[model samples]
Target: MPLSAWRLRLLIVSLLTVSFLGALDHTVVATSLATITGELGAVEQMSWVIVSYTLASTVLLPVLGKLADLVGARLVFLSSLALFVVASLFCGLAQDITQLAIARVAQGVGSAGLHLMPQTIVGEVTSPRERPKVMSWIGAAFPIAILVGPIAGGLITDAWGWRWIFWINIPVGMIALALAVIAVPHIAGRSGRRFDIVGALVLGVTVTAFVFAASWASAGTPGTGIPLLIAAVVAIVGLAAFIAIELRVSEPVVPLRHFANRTILVCIVLSTVIGVGLFSVVSYVPTYIQMAYGVSATVSGLVPIATVFGMLVSTLVTGSLASRSGHYRAFPIFGTAAAAIGLFLMALLPPGMPLWVPMLAMGLVGIGTGAYMNIIVAVAQSAAPRTDTGSVTATISLVRQVGSTTATAIVGGLIGVGVTAGLPASLDASTLTPQAVAASSAAVQAQVAELYSSVLAPIFIGLALAYAVGIVAALLLPHGRLSDELEPQPVVGAENAAETATA
Candidate 1:
C-alpha cells in the first residue's frame, strides 16, 4: 500500500530534521573551535576534533549503505540517530579534547547514515518524477545549516557555553526519532548477499589515509613533514589495493559497472569540479572578507547568508521545474555557468568595497551550488540499476568527499604560497593576523590588503576555471526524461501492510 499523503509529508520532515542536525553540528563546531581549544588545553590535538568526525563519516558511508541494503533503511536510520544522540551526550560531557575527539568519531559514524539514508528513503518512497522536489528540500538543509551555523554557534557560545552546542541536539533528536517511528515504512532488505568486508576495509583505509594526509598538508603544522609524506604514500597504495579488491569481490562495496554508464561518469566528474568550486567559496570567503575589509568575524559570517538565500530560492524553483519537465541537464549546465561568472565577479571586486558588492557575488555562486546539489545525485541514482541504488549513491558521495578534501588542500596551498610571495621577508608572514593588520600603519595596512587581494583574485580565478570545466562536463551529460523505474522487489508481510493501514 502507498503511504497516505500526510504520512509521507511527516516522514519527509523527519528525514529533513536529521539532515539539518547532521549538517548543523559540523558548522557549529567549526565556529566554536577557538573557544573549545582555549578551555580544553589541547591545542595540538584540536584539529582531530574535526578530522575524527570527517574520517569516521567518510569511511562509513558506503558501509552504511550496504548495511541498509542487507538489513533495512529504517533500522539503519534509527540506529544512526541513536548513536548520534548518544555521541552528542558524550561530547557534551567530555572533560578533555581526546574524549571529545573520540565522541566525535562516534558521532561521525551516525552522521554517515543521517546524510545518506534520507535520499535512499526518498528514492524508495517517491517515483523518479517526484524525487527532485523532495530531494531539493533535503539538499537545501545543508546550505541552510551552513548559513545558520556560525551565527548560532557564536550566539550559543556567548550566552550558554560551547558544550551547549552538543547538548542542543538531544531535544531535536528526540522529536526526529518519534516522528521516524510513526512515519517510516519497514522496507525489507535483500538476503543472501555477502557483505564486501575486504573491499570495505581497503577503501576505508584509503580514505582515512588520504584525509589525514590532506589535513596535514593543508594545516602545514610544524614538524609534520615526514608524517605527511608517509601518509600520502600510504593513501596511494591503499587506493590501488581498494581498486584491485573491488574488481574481484563477489559483491563490491562500490559496483564498478555503474561507472560504465556515461551518465554516472559525467555526473561524478562534474560533481568533483563543483565540489572544488563550491567548497572554496564556503571555506575561504569569510577569511577573505575579514582580511580584505577588516570586518569582525560575525559580520563576515553574515555575508554568506546571501549566498545561502540565493541557493535556497534556486533549489526550490529549479527542483520544481525539473520535476515538472522531467529534465535536469539544463540546471547543471546553466548553474555552472552562473557559478563561473559569480567567481569571476568575486575575484574582480576591489578591496574594501561596500559589503553588498561581495554579498551579491556570493549569491550568484550559491545559485550555482544549489543547482548542482540535488540534481547530480538524482541523475546518478536514476542512471544506476535499482538494486545498485545504495551502492551508487554511496560512491557518488565518496567521490564528492575526496573532491572536497582535495580542494581544501589545494586552496590552503594557494593561500600559503600567495602570502609567502607577497609579504616582505621581515614580516614573518606566518605570524601575521587580522589584529596585526588592524594595528599597522596606513601604508603597512595598504600593502597587506593589496597582497591579500592579489592572492584572492587568483584563488577565485581558479574556482572559475573549475566551474567552467564542470559546465563542459554537464553539457556531456545524457539527455532523457528522468527514469520512473520502480524497485524490482515488492513490499510484503502482513504486519507491514497493517502498519501502513493504521498510519
Candidate 2:
C-alpha cells in the first residue's frame, strides 16, 4: 500500500534532510577551512579538513552502501544520523586541528551512511512510479547544497563562529531522526549473508595509508620522507591484500570479475578520471579566492555558484538530449573538452583580474563537468547484471572516491610545498586569512595574488591535463545506449542527481 500523505511528507523530509546535510558538509567547509586552520594554528595541515572528510566518506561509500543493502537502510540511516549528530558535537568542541580532523573522520563515517542510504531507503519503500517526486527533491539537494554550503559556512564562521557550522547539524539531525521514526517504515534486510568485514577493513586501510602518506609528504615536515615511503609501501601491500581478499570472498566490496566486461572497464576508467577534478574544485577554490584575492568568506562562498550553475544547466540539457536520442558518448567527449578549456582559463588568469573572469572560467568547468555527471553511471549500471546493480553502483562510487583521493593528495602536497617555499615567513598559511589580506595595500595584495597565481597555475593546468586524459577515456568508451530502466536509486551518488532525472 502507498504511504499516506502525512507519512510520505515526513519520509521525504527525513530523506532530504539527510541528503542535504551530507551534501552540505562536502562544500560547507570550503569557505571555513582557512579560518579554521588560522584559528587552530596549523597551516601545513589545512588540507586535512577537506582530506579527512572526503577521504573518510569516500572510502566508506561502497561499504556503507552494501551494509545498507544487507541490514536495511532504515536501521543504517538512523544509526548514521545519531553518529553524525554526536560527531558534530565533537567537532564543535574540538580543541585543535587534529581534534577537529578526528571528529570529521567520525562524522564522515556517518555521512557515508547518511549520503547513500536515503535513496536506498526510498527505493526500498516507494513504488517505482512514485519515486520521481521524492527523487527530484533529493536531486534538488545537490544544487541547493552547492549554493548554500559555502555561503552558510562563510556567514556562520563570520558571525557565531565556524564551530557552529558543525553544531548546527545537531538540531537538524535530531529533527530528521524524529521524523524518520514517525514516518519511515522498516525495511527488512535483503540478504542473510555474512558482511564483508575483511573487504571493508582492507579497503579502508589501503586508502588511509595512501592518503596519510601523501598528506604527510605534502606537509614538507623534515625527516618525514622515510615515513612517507613506509606509507607508500603499506599502500602497495594493502592494495595487493585487498585484491586477493576480494577475489576469494563470496561478496566483495567491488568484484574484480566486473572488470571483465569491456564497457564496465571503460566506464570505471572514465568515471574515475572525471571524478578526480569534479569535487576538488570546491575543496580549494574558495580558500584560493580568500587567500589570493582577499575576498571575504561570504564572497568566496558565492563564487562556486558559477560552477554549480554551469553544471546544473549542462546536466539538465544534455541529460534530456541523451535520453531522447540514446546517444550518450558526446556529453563526456564535449564536456571534458570544455572543462579543459575552463581550467586553461583559470591557469592563465592574470593576477588582479576581475571576479567575473574566474566566474566565467568556473562556469565553463561546470558545463564541462556536468556533461558526464550522471550518464557515465547510468551506462555502467546498464552494463552490469541486475542482481549486482547496487554493488556495481557502489564500486563505481568507490573508484571515483579513489580518484578524488588522488587529486587531494597530489594537489594538497603541491599547495603545501608552494606555501612553504614561495610564501615568506611573515605570511604563514595561518596569517593569510581574508582579514590580513584585506588590510594589505593594493601593491601588497597584487604581489600576493601574483605569488598565489604562480603557485596555483600548475595545479590548474595539471587538472586540465587530467580532463584531457578523461576525454581520451571517453572516446574509448563504447558507443552504448543508456538503459531505459535505470536503477531507481542514483548511482551518481548524492553529489548530483537530477541529471539522470532529465533523461
- The alpha-carbon deviation from the true structure for residue 286 of candidate 1, after best TM-score superposition, in angstroms, is 1.3
Candidate 1: segments with Cα more than 4 A from true spot: 218-222, 424-428, 484-503
Local error of candidate 2 at residue 3 (angstroms): 10
Candidate 2 per-residue C-alpha lDDT over 166-234 given as tens digits, one digit per residue, 9 for 90 to 100: 998999889888887877787666678878899899888898888778667766678888999999999
lDDT for each of the candidates? Answer: 0.82, 0.75
Q: State the displacement of the C-alpha of residue 102, model 2, in Å, after optimal TM-score superposition.
A: 5.5
RMSDs, each prediction? 5.6, 5.5
User: For model 2, how many clashes?
Assistant: 0
